[model samples]
Target: MAAGGRGSGRPAKKKSPTKGTGGNKRRGLEGRGATPPAHLRHWHKDKARTERVEREERTGGKTSAARPQTRTRRSEDAPEYIGGRNPVLEALRAGVPAAAMYVALRIDNDDRVKEAVRLAAERGIALLEVGREKLDRLTEGGIHQGVALQIPAYEYAHPDDLVSIAQEAGEVPLIVALDSVTDPRNLGAIARSATAFGAHGLLVPSRRSAGVTGGAWKTSAGTLATLTVARASNLTSALREYREAGLFVVGLDGEGSVDLEKANLLDGPLVIVVGSEGKGLSRLVAESCDLVVRIPMHAAAESLNAGVAAGIALYEVARHRRR
Candidate 1:
C-alpha cells in the first residue's frame, strides 16, 4: 500500500536490484539451486535395501530372505545338520560353531563348497565324505547341494537362572521375553538390542518361538554368544514366577492403560514382554502383567517390529534407571 496506491492490485513485494547493487544479484540458479519437489525428497536410493534385493534376486530368493526355512523342521538332536551349500557356507561365515562338515562323495567343487572344505579344515571341524544317499536322509530329502554342516544344539538356561545371575552380580535384573516371534532374525536383533540396553538375558516360549539358529546368529552379529536366552514352557507361568521373585513384569501393548514413558518402575527388577507383530501380547500374558505399557508413537496405527519394540522398551528402562 505504501509502495503503490490502495486500489493497486499488483503484488506488494520488493524486488532485488540487478548486479552491482547492495548485493550481487547473480542469482541465476546459484547456490544449490532450488530444492527438488517434495516428491523428490526421497530421490536418494537406500543402498542397503537395494543390495538386499539384489542378493535375493541373485540367489533366487534363497538368501537371508529364506531364513525362516532355516527354522523349518530339523532333526531333534544335540548336533543338527544344516543342508545346502549356501546354508552351510552362510552358517560358517556367521561363525556358528560347527562340529563337522559333511560333503557328498565326489562333490563338484564350487566357491562355497571349496570355502566350506577349507573352513572346515582350517577351523578343525571334522570333514566327512559321505554318500548322497545318507545326506539325502540326513537332510530329510531336502536339497543338500552336496554339503551339510553340523551345529551344536542351543543350550537354554532356566528363566530363574537369569534373575539369579543378575542378583548375584548385584544388578537389577532386566530381562526380555518374546511371545510368538518366529523370525530368527528378529530374535537375533532383539538379543543385540537387549545386550546394548543392559538387559540381563532374554526369554522365549518353548513352542512357536524362534530358536537360536544360524540365521539368528548372523543377525545378532555375535551378540547371541554373550546374551543368555531362556525358553519358557509357558509365558504366563514365567511371568508369575518373575512376579513371585519380586520383579515387575511389564508387557508392551499398543492399547494398554499405562504409558511407557510414565512407568518409572524400571529402576528395580523388571522383565519386558514383547509380543508378535501381528497379534501383540497374548491375553493370558497380558493379564499377568503388573502393568501394561504402550509406547507413544509419532502417529496412530503405527508400530515397531517385535525386535525394535523390545529394544525401545529396554532403552526406556535403562534411561529411567540411569536417571
Candidate 2:
C-alpha cells in the first residue's frame, strides 16, 4: 500500500462540479424582500396582540374584551324556518311572506297541511318535499309536525324612519318602543296591540331586545307583516330623537305619577315605551320619557305584563284620539 497515495483504507472518490442556472441561484441568495410588519406575520407572538390593539383603536374601544381578539362578523340576516302544521297554516293565512314551503315526505295530509300547501301555492311560493330528517335539521329540532315554512329575515326599519313613515301616512306619529324585552312573544303581542290601536310602527333596541322571529310571527298572528318594526342602537337616544322630532315620549311604569287614561298627551304625536315584565323600565329609559304614566289596576296585581300594559295604554290613546 502507498503511504501518501491512495491507501488501503479505501481511495477517495472524485467530486463532480455542480451546474448552476444563469442567475436563478444568485437571485435566490440575494436579500429576500424586506420583513413584513409583526402583525402581518402569523408566527409572531405579538401578531394577535398587535391586531387586537389596532381593532380596539378602530372600534373606539367598543370591542368585547371577553371574546377572542380575532373577531368574525356573523350574518344575522339569514332566513328563518317555522315548523308545525298549525303554525304553517296560520302563517300562510296571515299572508306572511314565505319563500318556500317544505313538507316531509309521506307526511299525513291533514286539513292544516292541505290549507297551507294550497295557500302557499296560491302565493307562488315554491313547495319542496324533504325527508323528515332533513326537515328536523332545517327546523333545528323544533316540533315540525311534518311541515315548515321558510321566512326571509325581517328587514328592520331605522329608528328615524318610523317618524318619516308617520309623516308619509299623514298621521301623527304613534310609535311603540320596547325596552329590554327579550321575549319574541311579548314583542309580537305588543306589535298586535300597536297595530290594532293605530301605532305607525314599533321600536326595539338592537341588543337585549327581541327582533321578529318565528315565535313572534305566530304570536302576532301575522300582524307583524303589516306593521313596521324599527331597531335602535340605543333606546334612550332613540327616545331623545323622537322628542327632538316633536313626538311626546311616554313610559309605562307601575310607579308612574300620571294615569294613562287621563294623560292629555295621548291624543298628540306619541311614543309609548314598554319595559320588560321583570325589570320594568331601565333608569336611562325612564328618565328619557316625557311622561311616565301608569295603567289603573288593582294593587294586588303588582305589575302588568309588558304586552298587556302596552295594549291598555294604546287602547286609552286610541280612545282619546277618537274623542
Candidate 3:
C-alpha cells in the first residue's frame, strides 16, 4: 500500500501541520466591532436622512438643508428661479439676465403675467409652459402665483478689480464692504445707495454674508445691474489689502469714537464696512478698519438699519468727495 493513500487499510504516517492564518479566523468570528449608530452606518436605508437631520440640528440651521427627494439641490453657480408674478415681472423689468421663463399651463392670466410674458419675449428669453405641479416643484413650493423666471447667477467682480475700475475711471475709489450683513434686501438697498452715491463697487464676505439674489435685485430696483458686487474670502484680510493699496478702511460702529461727518478719511480711496443690523461690526472687522465712525443718531433711537446706515454714510462720503 502506498503511504498516505486514500482508503488505505494500514495506518498512514501523520502529515506535518501547515502555517496558521495568524488569528484571521478568530478576528472574523469577533464581527465588525459593535454596530455603528444608524446615522453613521453607510448601508442603512435611513442613514443619509438621519445624518442630514443631525447635521442641520448641530448647525442650528446655518447650513443648508438636504435637498428634497423630488429634486437635488442646485449648485451655487446655477441659475435661480424666482417665483411669484410680481417678482417675475419685476425681474424682467430690472433686466435680470434670464435663461428661461416658466409659466404654469392653464394659469389664470393677469396683467403681471401678460407683461412678464411680453418682456420675456422681447428679451428673447425662452418661455417654457409646464404643469402646475412641475412649476411648484421648480419654485420649491414658493408662492409662485403660476409664474417663475430663471435668472443667471450674478457675476461677482474681484476686490482688486474694483480698485482698478475706479482707477480706470479716474475717480477716487469708494467701496462698500459688508461685515456680517445676511439679508439680500439690505444688500440690494445698500447697492442702490452705493450707486446713487458714486461707489465703485460692493464688497462682502463670501460666507455669512448675502449675495446677489432675486430679493436683492428687486430691492435694488435694478441698480444692482449697474453696480458690481465682489466677494472676499476674509473680510478682514480684504480690508488689510485695501489699506496696503492706499485706501482707508472705515467701519460703521455705534461706539465709534469719531462721527461719520467728522471722519476726514472718506475723501480718499475708501472702504466703508457696514456691519449687520443687530450686531455692529465684528471684532476682527472693526479692528481691521483704519477708523471706526458712527452715524449721528438721536438719543431716542437705539440703532439704525444696516441699509439706512450705509446709505447715510455713503451720502456723507459722496458729499465730502464733491467738495
- Provide the TM-score for each candidate, comma-separated: 0.62, 0.74, 0.73
Q: In candidate 1, where is summed lDDT lowest over 10 consecutive residues?
A: 69-78
Candidate 3 residues 54-82, lDDT tens each?
Answer: 44423323456564455444456656667
lDDT of 1 at 250: 90
Error of 2 at 270 (Å): 0.3
Best by TM-score: 2
lDDT agreement with native, every candidate: 0.80, 0.85, 0.85
Ranking by TM-score: 2, 3, 1
Steric collisions counted per model: 0, 0, 1
Per-residue lDDT of 34 in model 3: 81
* Model 2: lDDT to the true structure: 0.85
The local lDDT score (0 to 100) that residue 196 gets in candidate 3 is 91
Tell me which residue pairs clash in candidate 1: none
lDDT of 2 by residue, 219-278 (tens): 787788899999989899999989998999999988889888879798999999999896
Which wins on lDDT, candidate 1 or candidate 2? Answer: 2
